[model samples]
Target chain A: MNPAPRSLTMDALQFSGTVTAAFSHDFKNTLAIIKENTGLLVDLLAMAEKGRPLDPQRLATLAERIGRQVQRADRMTAELNRFAHSADLPEAQTDLGAMLEMAVVLSARPANLKRVGLEAVTAPPLWIATFPFGLQQLLYRCIALLLDRAGSGGRIVLEADDGRPPVALRVIARTAEDRIPAGETAPTPTPEMTGLAHALQIRLDWDAAAGGWRLTWRDVET
Target chain B: MSERILIVDDETDFLEVMAERMTHRGVHVATAPSAQEALRQVEAGSFDAVILDLKMPEVDGLETLKAIKARQPEAQVILLSGQATLQDGIAAMKLGALDFLEKPADMNVLMEKIRKAQARKMLVVERRAEEKVKKIVSSRGW
Candidate 1:
């Protein structure tokens, strides 16, 4: 294989590692919350056994909290599972909206840590035959870059548009007043990201008017 | 007096449940949901030890630990995180954290660490008091 393809594979592996690590960290937090709540219940029950009165209301609340954490863990598990399978196929008929949503979900933890609000705008399904993992890596890298620029009190919106010959996806940054002023250098995508985009045949561009990055590719089918 | 400690974490649910559990074990507990709040609480009052989450939003635990140490060198801090890397653990310790514990840490193990922190803090306080007395005596030429 050429050095370019080999490097792209390494980049993909690195991206997968980062996403998996973030997901696992979140999953551990969910588990920790569940453990603490259950431990609290056990402590209360032990007290009751030793003659302290049991507060049925308190027990009910703890139970509810545990239930919610369990649901959270379940959702995280499903998402990670789906993400892992994305690499199984080199190219597949992928739902662009769903892919964007998954990217948003996986990037949520990092965005929150930076005090940035991230969300995916709802859109109708747009199908495309593409390398799922590569596309995800591209989307994630774009969002990560935007988040770095957005800083605190910033919001990022991910949108998918099926328009013209090249269906496009955008990562819009609604940041504070510190946006890059006109006449100054705009941030450029890293070499790794550029290489990944090239391998996937996606056109990645920074849209100055939109205050975000736009990724366009041809041959998107319904 | 019971051991007075502050627990700082961004997760409200974890904070609430952990505070209740610690309180039940006879520790006087206070909680902060952010690094700013934790700093405020530290400025407002003294704690035997601070249980700090390593991965808080805005100011993370290592930065907070440095700030707490600068403000009150006597304050003991224990770093806790759901995903603490080895490098983070070492950095925390080098920044004056008394100990580092991973999330879902056993209650017994946490309590033991807290107890050690309290003891170490008491020793520091006592040494400071002794130094103050010696300084006063020497200044008075007694």
Candidate 2:
């Protein structure tokens, strides 16, 4: 493959890997919680064996807690399932809000590490035709860049402007301190971001006044 | 005296469950929902072992480990990560963590690690005591 193509391929793989790692971590934590709960139940049984009366209500609540965790794990895996299949097609009709939602969830692990909040605000649903994986990569890069600039104790609120035809996204950093560094017109995009943005055909505009980032896609076949 | 273990994780379910299980095993266990709380707990009471979750919202596991070791040099730390990489494990070990274990960890394995951590803590405490005794003896020329 050509160098550019290879580089883009690697970028895609890296994006997928990052998301998978976060998802796997979440899944493991979920299982850990469940395992601990089950172990607690076993302990309770052991206590009962030792002539300590087992509260029927406590047993019921424990069972319910385990059930709740099972459901939580099921939802997480379902989101992960959809995320895994995002690249099944090179391009598809994708919901703008859902896409951003996935980006928020996947990038949350790192955002939390930096003490930055990443939230997907409610937006009117709009479907657009584009490369799902490429768009995801672009969003991921944008969020990563935002976090880097935001530093610790910052928040990035993401919402879509549905009034517009292209449905532009507004990723606003809640704190003014996280705004673009002094004298910098915009946040610098990493090489991967440049490559993915070029491939996906999207534009990023830094609004210093708004203290956030805005992404506009004009080639959408809505 | 029974072993006093401190469990720290953001997930309440995990912390509650782990605390209950360890308590049932006759180990005196305390739980912290966040690294900050864990730091406070460590300052308030010395523990034989600290089981810290790697990923947290504000203060991460590495930072927490550093703080704990600073406050209590003899304290033994065992890090737990849901998806720990080799590099993560190496970093934790270099930071003086007794061990790094992946999440959904086997109970038997964890119990064994806790025992080892307790032993390591004892050795560290004893070594410090010995140094203090030597210092005193030298100061008295005895």
Candidate 3:
């Protein structure tokens, strides 16, 4: 069997793979703590089984937390598998709704969820002709920041409108201090998001006067 | 029949919370704090889907996914992370994850994704079974 030519795909694969490697490396320590805590819960459960009275509140909390991590771990396994394999498929005629769904899912940080609201305004599923996840993550980061900054009561509105060709997604960042999380004094978009916006040919405009930020992609092929 | 969902993560607290929440949501949930334990559960149980964390001690997310797919090919996998970067998100999607959800994800969104994953599971299972049947029938009947 003949293998596909490297020139067509090697670079993108390597680039994304390296980035994910770095990302996982960043979260490794946190993951370890979670594991340790999980072990603690098991011990507590064992003690309870032995007729030992554990802190009811602590036990309940531990149980709740353990479950969350399990779910989280499950999600990561599936995500990494899907991502590593998605590189092999031709760029999907991606749907905007699905993209929006992914963006919300990716922006699932405590700050983003509590501080801001994701209002998807465009219903027409735009058929995008590019790497969907890549673009989705990029856009999600941008919206995440806005949501993070907005604090617990902040708002971010996502809308899609036709420009030169295919409809372009617009992320409106509306932030307020109340939207920011405790101990977090400010809100900022990550370099990854900015870099992605550039790569996807999307334009980002921040209005300091209006306290709003906007991202738009023009002439994106239909 | 109980709709069992497997949850794998390094954090005991997070796993417990997820199991509790899902259980409350009327889904049968299982929890594993480490990739190895998760693999054990995957080997033993016929879970409708799996929720995996990106980073964990000993067995990491990618390796665990490889193991799960190898053993339980029918299990639907979803990736979750607290420190998700643009790269990891894309990588997860590329790797065959039904979806990649960031940490502290919205409950509504998680439930919605779960539904989508479960909804697709039957179709995927039947298709695989059909393929095997076709191969068997074609060789004998044709």
**Candidate number achieving the greatest TM-score relative to the actual structure:** 1
| Candidate 2 lDDT score at position B77 | 96
Candidate 2, which segments miss by more than 4 Å at Cα? Answer: A1-6, A148-153, A176-185, A219-221
- Please tell me which model should have the higher DockQ, number 1 or number 2: 1
Candidates arranged by lDDT, highest first: 1, 2, 3
Candidate 2, residues A152-221, lDDT tens digits: the string is: 7777778888646675888776544654434445777677777776677777777787766777786664
Q: How well does chain A score by TM in each candidate? A: 0.91, 0.86, 0.53
Best by DockQ: 1
Clashes per candidate, residues 3 or more apart or on different chains: 0, 0, 72
Q: Which candidate has the top score in lDDT?
A: 1
After the best TM-score superposition of candidate 1, give how far the Cα of residue A180 lies from its true spot, in angstroms: 8.9
Q: After superposition, how far is residue B7 of candidate 1 from its true place, in Å?
A: 0.6
Model 3: what is its DockQ? 0.02
Total clashes in model 3, counting residue pairs 3 or more apart in sequence or in different chains: 72
Tens digits of per-residue lDDT for model 3 on A116-155?
5666665756776666656655665566456545554666
The chain B TM-scores of all candidates, as shown, are 0.97, 0.97, 0.92
- Candidate 3: deviation at residue B43, Å? 0.8
Q: How accurate is candidate 3 locally (lDDT)?
A: 0.65
TM-scores for every predicted model: 0.95, 0.91, 0.42
Evaluation by TM-score, superior candidate among 1 and 3? 1
Q: Candidate 2, residues B1-142: lDDT per residue as tens digits? A: 5788999999888888888788777789999988889999999998999999999976889999999999998899999999899998999999999999999998889888888888888888899999999999999999
